[model samples]
Target chain A: SAVISQKPSRDICQRGTSLTIQCQVDSQVTMMFWYRQQPGQSLTLIATANQGSEATYESGFVIDKFPISRPNLTFSTLTVSNMSPEDSSIYLCSVVLPKSGQGGLGGYTFGSGTRLTVV
Target chain B: GIQVEQSPPDLILQEGANSTLRCNFSDSVNNLQWFHQNPWGQLINLFYIPSGTKQNGRLSATTVATERYSLLYISSSQTTDSGVYFCAVLINAGNNRKLIWGLGTSLAVNP
Candidate 1:
């Protein structure tokens, strides 16, 4: 298990403004992912951040709206550009630990989440 | 893409009762995880049983990879267990680890 933390557990922002959320892990991880959860809905994968490479975004998401930066293996940042009322949701960061052997069991460690409320 | 399904979209259980949640996947996966989201919106990982059974206190999970299904059992439920339980699956294909998430089951434990 890894200890994960997110900054600004929650925040209220005005429309048209942008908010950058930061995620940090206790140890180095190979894979880091961003997710969004709307009220009364399931989790949606936003993108996967890799060190020294451009983030790989999901089909419905783009880099322009959600820019990601991963400068190192243990830290990453996600900025929500041009916030809107619809952008109000919980953003979570997750990391997959490396397995010990081939086809070994591994799980994801997620941050507490950042709750963004856009008015 | 792999499809994941969870049964009993919503459940209400009294304290001290036992319950089981099920997760079914459409394809074979190399990794399977169960998570518990508390009222505070914190996701606590419960199990990483991709092929076997694991137990932690009052919570236990079993995954049958060949059958593409997993079971999560909660014994002696408490009010603190009232929240959503999510099952995530990751299949090993190509060289990428892509995880598919399920809708989750919402459980409410009343005291």
Candidate 2:
């Protein structure tokens, strides 16, 4: 299992302002992903951050709106650029654990999440 | 893209009662995971059962990969177990492990 942590557990920001959330893992991970959960909704994948490369975003998401940066294997950041009321959601970071090559398969560990409230 | 469907979108159970949640996938998937969102809005992973069955204390999960379905069993539910349960799956191939999430099952355990 991997231990994940995120900065700014909860923040209240005004509309049109941007906030950068940081995710740090206890150990190195191959892939880091950003997700969003709307009010009373399930999680939706935003992008996959790869170290030394550009992030791959999912449909309905773009780099301009949500810029991601992965400077190393254990750290990444997600910036909600040009925020709006619609962008007020819980953002979480997750990492895939490495397999032990035995009967056990790898799982995902998610951060505590950064809850952003846009007013 | 894979479609995930969870049954009984809302459930209210008494503490100490048992409950079962189900997840159905549209296509073959290489990965299946269950997550619980607490009232504080933290997504806590429950299990990663792509196949077979595994139990952890009062929680157990079973995934029939070939049938494209999974089941999560909660025995002797507690007030702390009241939250939303989500099931996600990775479909197509292994190139991208992008998870498609279900709307989730909201379980409320009343004392």
Candidate 3:
């Protein structure tokens, strides 16, 4: 299992401000993703943070609003820009082990999540 | 795009009771996994059953990929088992490698 240390577990921010969440995985991972869990809802994929490349955003998600940075295999960050009330949610970081994840041996790993509230 | 649906929406069970949760996908999936979101908001991997049956302690899961459904079984449930259970799938048909998710089943186990 790859452990992820995510910072700023919870935060209260002003409407115009921005917040950046960080995740540090215990080991190098080829696949890292950012997810958002809306209030009283299920998890939604935000984007796939690729090391040394631009992230691949999902439908209805854009780079300007939810920019991600994967500086290396073990480190990544997602910044919620120009925060608004609608941006408030529980943001999570997830990973997949390339070797073990294949042949049904692999699974997704996740961070504890960062709960954000924009006022 | 794949649609994943989880049943019962919400569930409440007395401690020591057994419960079953199900997940159904709209299309075929080569990978499927069950997760437990604890009260503290941590996503814990419960099972990675893309197919067949697997048991771990008091929890077990079975996935019939051919039929596009999966089941999670919890026996002798405890209050600590109360939380949201989610089924996530990875569809790798052609170039579609996106991970699809279910709305999840919220469980409340009381003492």
DockQ of each: 0.68, 0.70, 0.77
TM-score for every candidate vs. truth? 0.95, 0.95, 0.95
lDDT over C-alpha atoms for residue A70 of model 1: 97
Q: Between candidates 1 and 2, which one is better according to DockQ?
A: 2
Off by over 4 Å in 2: A101-105, B92-94
The Cα RMSD across the true interface for model 3 is 1.3
lDDT values for all models: 0.90, 0.91, 0.90
Estimate, for each residue in B1-111, the C-alpha lDDT of model 3 and write its tens digit. 689999989999999999999999988787899999999899998888789998989999999998999999999999999999999998773343667899999999999
**Candidate 3 CAPRI level:** medium
Error of 3 at A34 (Å): 0.2
Candidates in descending lDDT order: 2, 1, 3
**Given candidate 1, what's the lDDT at residue A84?**
99
Model 1 spans with C-alpha error above 4 angstroms: A99-105
Model 2: lDDT of residue A59: 82
- Each candidate: how many clashes? 0, 0, 2
